[model samples]
Target: MTDAVLKIENLQTYYGKSHILHGVSMEVAEGEIVTLLGRNGAGKTTTLRSLSGLTPPREGRIEIFGNDTTRWPAYRIARLGVGYVPEGRRIFPNLTVLENLAVPMTRPGPWTVDKVLELFPNLGTRRDSWGRQLSGGEQEMLAIARALLVNPKLLLLDEPSQGLAPLLVREVFRVVASMREQGISILLVEQNARFGLEVADRVYVLNDGQMIHSGPARELAKDEERVRALAGVGGKEDGVLTAKPKTSAA
Candidate 1:
């Protein structure tokens, strides 16, 4: 990959006595979107956590913006222009929309309170509303908006489309696509394989803590059977990933 904003090599991580990720590796090029697809407990979230420094890898190399950050703390990693939007839309329920947006430790960049509000106008209308009062879509939007305030070069999004209506999912993806145009590389963990394949430039599939396939999103999206097989989406697991050009080891 050219101009890679983030790269992980032979990553191995664990939780207490349980080994989770097994030599999983992937990269996100500058201004590109790379989606991580897998069934529940495929070590998808663990990968993001490791990259964000919330859970330092047991072994591996993590380079962000060409810096060796394998042992950096979570706050230090955030300072390197990496914005992470974790699963569950972790917002300050007691804070207003405006307050929640203002909470992130910001950096010097184009993403500001007003700019993100403009990008997510639904949030703008409810600026005075408490986060707890917002709908699920609104909460998700708020979460994304809060992360953008960090003015990151790379964004890590975990399940941004989970538990939302079909139309809302499209809206979330549309916003995500727009971020690429603004030059923010994204590493997205998405449960909805179809949406992940549709919006991402490249795709990585993980099964049982191992990478099964990596290729162009368009290439994999062409075969519905292959998508379901590699990702286990819709619960129909079949077929193995054959040799494909540009495949990144998971």
Candidate 2:
């Protein structure tokens, strides 16, 4: 664990009156693409939120780059070399592309507007356009680029492939895959098992807010029965499975 970039030990989280995660613990090693794979509402987003301290786990601990920041505020956690690109591509709808990309800059060593545009030329072409003006794919690219501009050591990505066409999904995943090549560690939460497993070095599957499966991405991809049964992707529907996500320890 000496080289672990992010660590969660028996973490528990809550949402007002509801409990969500249940003794959940995981780790992201430095410069690796590790994904949390789950069905919709399997506490994937909440896990990312807890890691980023947006919703701090009520129990257990969160460590970023070996520093304990369990009680830190979201901004403080963000300042600890962690950047999160949330689900739904939560960019500022009213801001221009340039404005959105610049909103999260702290000291900025490498990720500049010109540089991000160079990486994503389509976004460069729409630099002056409003956030809402871009398509879903374009907005996702913009959101990710904005996070990278801060030179974050660990990136928490929630459902980066959601709601995009196959072509755009490929485009975004390629960008994510490239982040590892650039030596940026990633903790990705994704529902697209196929693509998630394809790029991930390691993966964890969450079911009913519990860690039911853990293995190399390739192994999980090959287990058809497990993929269909516990994953909620194939076979008879399980009535116990619900879409309302809660925060708890898993």
Which regions of candidate 1 deviate over 4 angstroms?
A: 234-250
The residue-by-residue lDDT of candidate 1 on 1-250, one tens digit each, is 6699999999999998799999999999999999999877899999999999999899999999999999999989999999999988998999999999989899999989999999899999999999999998999999999999999999999988877777888899999999999899999997777778889999999988889999999888788888777876731222112211123234
Query: TM-score of each candidate?
Result: 0.92, 0.91
Q: What are the per-residue Cα lDDT tens digits for candidate 2 across 1-250?
A: 5789998888788888687888788888998899897776778888888888898888989889888988898887787778789988898999999899879856456667788899999998899999999998899999898888777889999988777777887888899999898788999887666677778988888866678887787787776578766566532232112212232123
After superposition, which runs of candidate 2 have C-alpha atoms over 4 Å from their true positions?
234-250
Of the candidates shown, which would achieve the greatest TM-score relative to the real structure?
A: 1
Worst 10 residues of 2 by lDDT: 235-244
Tell me the number of clashing residue pairs for each predicted model. 1, 12
Give RMSD (Å) of candidate 2 vs. truth: 4.8
